[model samples]
Structure formats: structure tokens, C-alpha cells
Target: MTSTGNIRPMNDKKYKHSVAVLISDGLGTFEFGIAVEVFGLTRPEFNFPWYKFMVVSTQAKAVNASGGVSIAANYSIEALSVCDTIIIPSWHSYSDKKDALLIQKLREAAERGVRFLSICSGVFLLAQAGLLDGKKATTHWKHLPKFRRAHPQIELDENALYIDQGNVICSAGSAAGIDACLHLVRKDFGSQIANQVARRLVAHPHRDGGQTQFIPNPVAKLERNAISNSIDWALANLSEQITIKEMAMQAHMSDRSFHRRFRDTTGVSPLHWLQQARIAKSKELLETTNYKMEHIAELSGYLTHETFRVAFKKRVGVSPSAYRARFRSD
Candidate 1:
């Protein structure tokens, strides 16, 4: 997603909603751009009241980024006062020292009603300012050990894409920044507007802040490779009552070993994996054909309508009927 050497509001009368994006040395241009793309870009198509964004630095001058790139920061720390929302994109350990004045300004800004967000390593700066005390927040998973050791009082959420405790929003590593920024847009506007923007950006419209951030996750891919032939066989004959033992035999493993290995391979248990796949297949039938739920449940390998409903709700976040209502047949 980098191009040309990495080339990267409105006022709701109720909020006036000006956002101050605080930048410092070694900032991640990509993270800053994500904030700008959502907040600064003029999206007349969405016809929404957009936010005003300001790029403020610790000091008003050219600052050095990682890899020795220089960018100008025209605004000073004084801009914090008028901001309705404040975003801190990142902080890097430059010569192993953080700017003290920057932490003071973050403290001052938090004391006001300004909404706060820290993407990736920016949580370090926020935690240093003591704004995250007693609030559940997330950062890049790599920083969890050090962050907890530094601020044990702050509740750290490791599994989520992001976490929103009203005034404060913290995102997991890099991509979660988009999820958080889009979420702020969705919260201010509505699902229709958010979906429109997601279409423009070619990103998902709705990801709950609590969605899991998969780390490395070679286990799923490796297991899927081993179980590929079996999965294909199961898919072709889903109408048959396929037992776990049958699948274990196909993968050439004992039932007990298959149970442990499958759970380790996928984040979920074998039953949940089957249920997830079944729910996806049923949804396709629901949209393309006039199949009844009972029929779909049977065809999709779900044993009963009640079991399908429970599994569908648990995995898809909606009932089959509700999903079809929201989706188009075409």
C-alpha cells in the first residue's frame, strides 16, 4: 500500500469535532496517513460532517522520521486546547529517550473532554502521561510485557483489534489503526455512511473492536494443508453424518491426537470449525436459493435447526434470517 516513495471535517454543531494528531520524532507515516485518510480527506460522496485534523509536533519545526526522512510540523503543542479529539499515532525509542514536554501536553489534553486515541506504540506515550490508568487499552502485542511492568494499574487488552472505553481508544499494532479510525467514523455517523467509506477504501465496514488479532498463525495453514484432502471429501459429501473419528482417520491420526491437534491448529475447536464452515455454506444457499432453514441445515451438515441457529448466532453475530434481510440476493 506504499506509493511514490510512500506518498499518503466538518463540524457537527454538537461536537465541532476538531482532531489534533500529535506527532513526534520517528513517527510512522503510514499510521499518520490512516488518521488523515479518515479524518482529513474530503468525502463529499458520503455527505457527512467531517472532522478537522491538525498535525501538531512537540516543537513547531521539521522533525526527523524513521529512516532519516524529514517532515514539517507547522502546528505546535498549543493546538491541543481546541481539539475535540486527539490522536497519537506512534512513538519510537530514539536514542532511548522520550520528550518530556510531549507527555505534559498529552496530560493537559486528556484533562479536557478531548477523546484520545493511540495507535501501536503510541500507547507508551499515553501511558507515560498517566491517561490510561484504570482504563482497559490495547497496544501492539509485542509491547504488552514491558507496558504491564511499567503500568500495572492500566488494564491491557491483548486479543482485540482495538478497545474503546468511551473517551479513550487504543488499537493493536498497525492495521488495527484503520479499524479504530473507521469505528470513530461509524460511531459519529451510521452503518450506511461507514459502509460507503469502507467501499471507497476497499476495507471491511464493521469489525468489532474485540475481534482477535491473529499472530503468526501458521498452525491453521499447516493443519489445513494436512487436512486438505479430508476437508474436500467432507465438503463433497456434507449431507452424510461425518464423525470426528472419520476426519481423524482421513488425516491419518488417532482420534485423541486429532482432537488436540485440531484445536491447536485452528484457534477454535473442531466442532466450531465445522460449525463455522457450515454457517458460511448455509448463508450462500439462503442468498442464492429459496431453501428453508431446515433444508439448509441438513445440506450444510448441521444436524438440527436449533443447533444451526445457535451456531450461526455464535459465529456470524446474527441469525440467518437477519443476515438475509441485510444482504441482497443478486
Candidate 2:
């Protein structure tokens, strides 16, 4: 019935955070599992406190998940008031009638500054609660049309993998939920801890929330592998002055062909991907090492400190020094 795995740690230290995953009937098991795997699992390997996670529902009744599975909540909706964050894994449907009691609870939690994160269509609940009014939100591409029609007041970002509006966050379909959760972990703990959790899950450490959600055309297997290999090579050589010609050579394709395929596979231009990769590398260095801005810029493939500063500020909305001071792991 009720499950509270790893909510209690070995030591008596207070948990640094608390999370409540709200579930309902017709749940997306994969999304629910993502929340559980990321927040509910205990990591004794880490020295710091982890989240105290629990499942909550509007009622104590068991809900039906996909594939004929049933899950019961560990706590009632009232438990949400005590949580630092509340995760809505999935909801019934856009057409389903709103739950007034649950909506009231969500509004109350928002007023109290509890962070709300919704995966996929679970955003509908937040939208119904008026918590996402005038705020940008995203959902599975399939649900975008209905969501837009239903909540014209909410700004819909169909291309984004997730949108973080301060206390409220909404993620796109399925795997994108993992990215959103990891982003939260990175924000709350640090990149190092988030990366460690990502490693355990065998997922990418970070994906920019603004990154395009899906590639339009799927490349053939061989072509896909070639594109993947090129990305791997680029990541390995972030410090090098990588050119489109060089990346094409690595992929064994003509420059034009490589560019097309890379965009088709990754949903972004090759140069844009490179810039994002370099920014990611610079962020890791900023958070982990005491390297000066010039050194970090060099390591992140920028030839000049001015170029690095401009790029970092444009993409991250903060300067290198500010990012380092805020997110550097002690």
C-alpha cells in the first residue's frame, strides 16, 4: 500500500530537503519511477543529507497505473504542506475534471513557497490550480495542442525539454522528466552530487532546459552511430579549436551532409551544440576547480576571455565568477 523507501537515513542528521510525489489514477509509471529513483533512493556514499521522500495522494485509495498496476500513497494530500517540493508525476487527462480539493491544496502550497514540479501532463493539474498562469510551461508534444487550447493564458513552450519558473517547474514527456529532476538536484545540492546521482541512473549529467525536445527526423542506425561518435569526439576535445570540417572528418561525412545529419539527430546546429558543450564544460570547471576565468575559458575551448564571458552570460544569465561563487562545491 504505502511506500516510503529510504526516507530514514542511518544518521540522525535532519534531511536537507523533503519531497512529496503526488500520484493519481492513470499514472505514467515511468514518470513516477523517475521521481522515486531520483528522490526516494538513499545514497549512503554521499556525505550530505538527502531528500526525505514520500508518496501522497488526494485520498488514501490506491490508484491504477498503466499495465494494470496499482499503487497506494504513503500520505494524504495534507502532507504536501510539509514538503519542500512536490512532484506531480502524471495526471489523468486534459479533459478530466479538475479536483477542487487538490487544486486548493496546490495553491496553498504555492503560497507557502513550496516548489511544484510537474512531469508531462501532470502540468494540467498546476494549470487547473492557476499556479502556472502567465508562466511558461511545457508538456509532451502530443498533449501540446489540447493544453494550449485548454489554458490559453499559460505560455506554452513546446520546444523546451522543461521550463523552470522559479518555484514552479514543468517538464516535457517521459525522459525529459529525468532532466528536470536532475536540474532540481543540481540547484538544491550541487552539480557534483547531481552528477553522481545521474551516474547511478546511467543518464546524462545535464541537459539544458531550453534544448529542443525531439529530433524531427531519425537518422539510420549507421548514420546515428556516426553522429553519436562525432558528439563523443567533440566532448573529448572541448579544449581544441573544433571546426565543422574537423567534426565532419571525424564523422566520415561531407561537411554539408554532416551538418544536416547532426542537426537532424540532435535538433540543433553543430556549432550551437559545440557552444553548449563548451559551456557545460566551463560550468563543471567553475563548480569544481579553483581555475581562473582565463584558464577555464581556455579549457572550455574559448580562445579569448571576452568570448567566454559573453557566451557564458548569454546562455547562463550569470558571469563566471558569480556562477562559481554560487554553485562551487566546498
Candidate 3:
């Protein structure tokens, strides 16, 4: 059972393609639930091959989850031998040492080119199995310091939503698992199938792995309403040239006070926020319209196309045209 000699490609004809999820005590149920939601459901409508799913427990008996819940495993570690894909939802605790047998099963799976994935803190198991050595991986941002201290050999990203290294995949915090699962569908099938799955799940169709996990949300309302109102006005008038003075005036405050308060509330300067808003608007235009570069620049509050290109590349890591080509729908 520990050997991967029986491992077969997903396209193998004799045995139904298998996906085994590794479960253990103290694991996050939400991360494990995502695997079941994404891969366990039957999709006869797609007219594609159906995967055989099994929950493989690391131990012999029922495993207890975070909330005093116990999962009766349908299979033991031996079940991993035949699986085309192995998923680890979340290893809830970094302090616990994984059993050697489970680690050996994973290592053998890796040797056979079997796809293995981890969501959130589940990455700790892969690192324990030595699968993430020298590979760039990511986990929940809060655990970054601990992950770095424990496994200095692995390259852990603090910002990415997910990272794929062929056979091994790692996803960021809790919700990011959806993006990673969709990415797997997209990679295994195609964009069309991925989009269909996303629609079925009522999730965003695509959010590339390179995108940031930390999006700066708007500040909560303050007692002083003028600043929020002015910010709203700025969003409405993104096409026009706006200045710090205009924003301050709209807030009925002097330049110095507005700057200080804006920073305190939003964690960014007003001008910086304005630039981000303009860039966001430009992305919307790029995805939904066929606007030319100059027109888009003008509409997004940039004075020149050259300035727009520089700013977009600096912030988004791609040119306007490239972004549109990748994200344009219909």
C-alpha cells in the first residue's frame, strides 16, 4: 500500500480516476469541505470522466476535527496508492509532527508524479514530507513567520493566492482554496469547463494566482462624513483631473488635515488611493470595452498614454493590452 506501483494516469481506462483526500485530527473542516465541493460532486452534464473520491485517514480510527467533530474515514493510508490526485485541506496545527507512515505515502506519491495539493496550513504537511524543498509555495499569511522559521529551505510567498509547481500545489489562506481548485479545473480541462464550474459554484470565474491576497478594503465610516462623501465623488468623476486641493476642499478641510486623516483611516495617502481607483477603473474598461490606449488613459484620469502604461505595469505587473487579452470576456 505504501508503494506507488499501482498509480495510473487520470486517463487510464481500467480503473476510474481517483482523488484521495488526506484527513487527520485537528484539520480545518472548511478547507477539507472545498475539496469535496469542487471534486466530489457528480457532473454528468459535462459529459466528462467522473473521479472516484475517497477520504483517507492518516490514523487507523476516526479523526477529530477542530470543533469537536469526528470524521469516520472510509479508507486508510493505503487508499492513496491508486489515486491520481491527493489533496490535503488544512493541517490545523504546525506544532504537531505528522505520522511517518503518512509522510512516506506522500513522498511515494510524489515520486510517481501523482498530483498533490494543500490548502492553507496543509502546506506544513508537504514541507514535512520534503515535497516543497526549493519550490515556491504559499500558506496563510499569518503563519508566514512560523513557516519561514521551520522550513527555511522552502520558498514561501506571503502574498500570492496560490502557487503551482507541476505536481505539487499550495494555496493561500482559507478562501483562496476556491481559486486554487478552479485553477486545477482550468488546468485539467480548459477555461470553458472552469468557467462552467465557477458559474455552478457562483464564484468569480478567474482570479490569477499572481494576484495579491491582501486587497485594501475601504475604511469604515467616520463621524466626519465629508471625507467619505468626497471619496465617493472622486470615484464618480474618475475621468476628470482631480487634485489634493480639490479633494480637501470637497471634505471641507485644509490640505494638512485631510492628508493626515486620510492616512489614518485608509492606511494610504489620498493621492495613492486615487491612483489605485484610477487603475481599477482602467481594468474595468479594459475587460469590458474595446477602448484604445489613449482613450482609456483619458478616461482613467491619466494625462498621457505613456503615463498610464508605466503606472499599470508598475502596479499590475502587465501592460494594458496584455491584461485585456487575458481577462476580456466574450
Candidate 4:
């Protein structure tokens, strides 16, 4: 397998990584489609080489997907040996019964340092193969209880949209898989390239994996729209010191009502949301600019450089300078 541990800058003329999308019976077509759309599609418009993609199966045969769809896999599991990354779109039935041969191959692949990505219930396959025993993993929220019961050793994060444990990555559910895959693109290429890919897909360019999943809401449309509008206003004014009272005023609700409705709409508190938004903005500036730390902090809504550094490091797990060093596009 090719080395994906240290990806170089995106200025390279060619990206040599080969990505294999693993398909099996009872596949989630939407999740499978997400993988194919992100990694499989050829983007001739880009100046560099896109991923060398292929669809593979455990038995190298046709498999049935959800909703009565069937797809024929031209490559077998043996093909994974030469691939740099394997995307397990989904598993068959989320069953406890493990495929001995498949498990052996997966373990071998892990030993070789090949990357593994599981979408939704596909985490079950990795868990059953013993790949996620001591690692942090997450699946669709609906399966959290069962996942915990089955894999008590794995540290499960209930709120994360996705979790990237170095070589192993797991996504929450169907749509979150798109964010996870786009994140891999950003890691391999740069933020600019990833943003372009996202534009083509008509999806959000960047959603931090730590952002909480959208909880089901039975709130009225008017209330939801008000909260959404307030969120938009806050985003537009991220450079300013935004107060909860100001936000509540924008939503046209009392502070208490705004608090409850905001939490109901977005899984985090209003303050938490503002902090995350500021962090996200700081990250974008860091990735795209060579500005000084103080200037970046000011632009990201921090009152002082010290506060910005503390908040950024706390939220992102790294200081601004270090993050720029790792992910800066130019």
C-alpha cells in the first residue's frame, strides 16, 4: 500500500493514492453513492491527478443494495493490498457474524498501514474485525446503544459527526459520510481543492467533525426559521463581540425562549455555537493567509491574542501557528 501518513503539499503534479470502495450485500446505496461521488468520479478539470478509484467486493461478485439495487464488483478483496485507502460504505445486515476471510484481510491491511474508513453501520465490520478495539469510533446516532453494547472496549463519541483516529475514520450516518470524505480530501490535497470539490458536489465546504449532529426537532417552522436567521446574523458578524442578548433580540424572542429553541434547533448552546463559528473562521484564515497571529485573532472575533490562542487551541487541539503549518494551502 502507498504511504498516506505524510501527505505533501497539493502543488504536486500527481496524486498517486489508490482508493478502493468496498461493497457488499445489503449496502446503503446513498452511502455507497457518497463514496463513489467523492473519490471515484474523475475530475479532469483539476491540474493534479485525482484518486485512482475502483469498486471491490469481498467475493468479487454482484451484490444487492438496499431498495433492490444490484451492483457488480469487478475487483475482489485482494485488490485492497495495493490500494492506499479502503472505504467501507456499509456492511451486510450489521450482523454479529463476521467473515473470517474478510477479517483476516482487514487485519493484514491494518498491519500494512492502509487507511480504513467506515460509513454508518460499516463501523460494525471494523469493530468485529477488531480494528477499533482501543480506538475512538462513532456510527449513526440511532445505533449508538447497540454499538456500545457490542463493542464495550471502543470509546464511542455520541455527538461527533465523524471521528478520525489517524488511519481509521468513522462517520455518523448517511450524509455525514460526505463530510468525512471531504475531510480526507482536504487532508490529502489542500483546503482550496477540497472547497472546489465541495462546490461541485453542492455541499457545505467544511463542517467540523466535532459539530453535533442535528437532533430531530418538532418545533414550528416559524421558530426554526427565527433561530436559523439569528445564526446567519451571528455568522455574518463573527468579527464582533456577539452577546446572547443580541442574538436573542435578532431571533425576536426572550433570552429564555431563545435558549431553548436554539438548543432544540442546533445541538449546541448559542455561546458554544458562536465559539465554534469563530474557531472555524480562524482556521480558514490560517489555511489561506500568512497574517500574524494577532491579526488573525482580531479577525476571528477574539478580544485579545491570548484569548484567541487559548480558545483556538482548546477547540482545535492545536495552536494557530501549528495548524497553519499543517494545513496551509499556500
Highest lDDT: give the candidate number: 2
lDDT on C-alpha atoms for all candidate structures: 0.73, 0.89, 0.81, 0.86
Q: Compared with the true structure, what per-residue lDDT tens digits does model 1 show for residues 1-330?
A: 111121112234423367878777688888887888878777678443467667787755677766668767656776776677889888862233656777777777778767888898888877777888888888888878877787789888888898887888999888899989887875565445566777888886656676667634455665666676666766676777888788888877788877777755544456655655575577667666788889988998878998888888886667878766665354
CA shift of 52, model 2, Å: 1.0
Task: List TM-scores for all candidates, in order.
Answer: 0.63, 0.92, 0.65, 0.88
TM-score of 2: 0.92
Candidate 4: lDDT of 9?
36
The lDDT of model 2 is 0.89
Return whichever of 1 and 3 wins on TM-score.
Answer: 3
Off by over 4 Å in 3: 1-16, 219-330
The number of clashing residue pairs in each candidate reads 3, 0, 0, 0
Q: Extract clashing residue pairs from model 2.
A: none
Q: Candidate 4 residues 135-248, lDDT tens each?
A: 999898888998999889899999899998889999998999999999899877766788889999999887778778777667899999999999999999998989999999
User: Where does model 1 exceed 4 Å of error?
Assistant: 1-16, 93-101, 219-330
Ranking by lDDT: 2, 4, 3, 1
Q: Candidate 4 versus the native: TM-score?
A: 0.88
Candidate 3: C-alpha RMSD after superposition:
6.6
Per-residue lDDT, model 2, residue 185, is 95
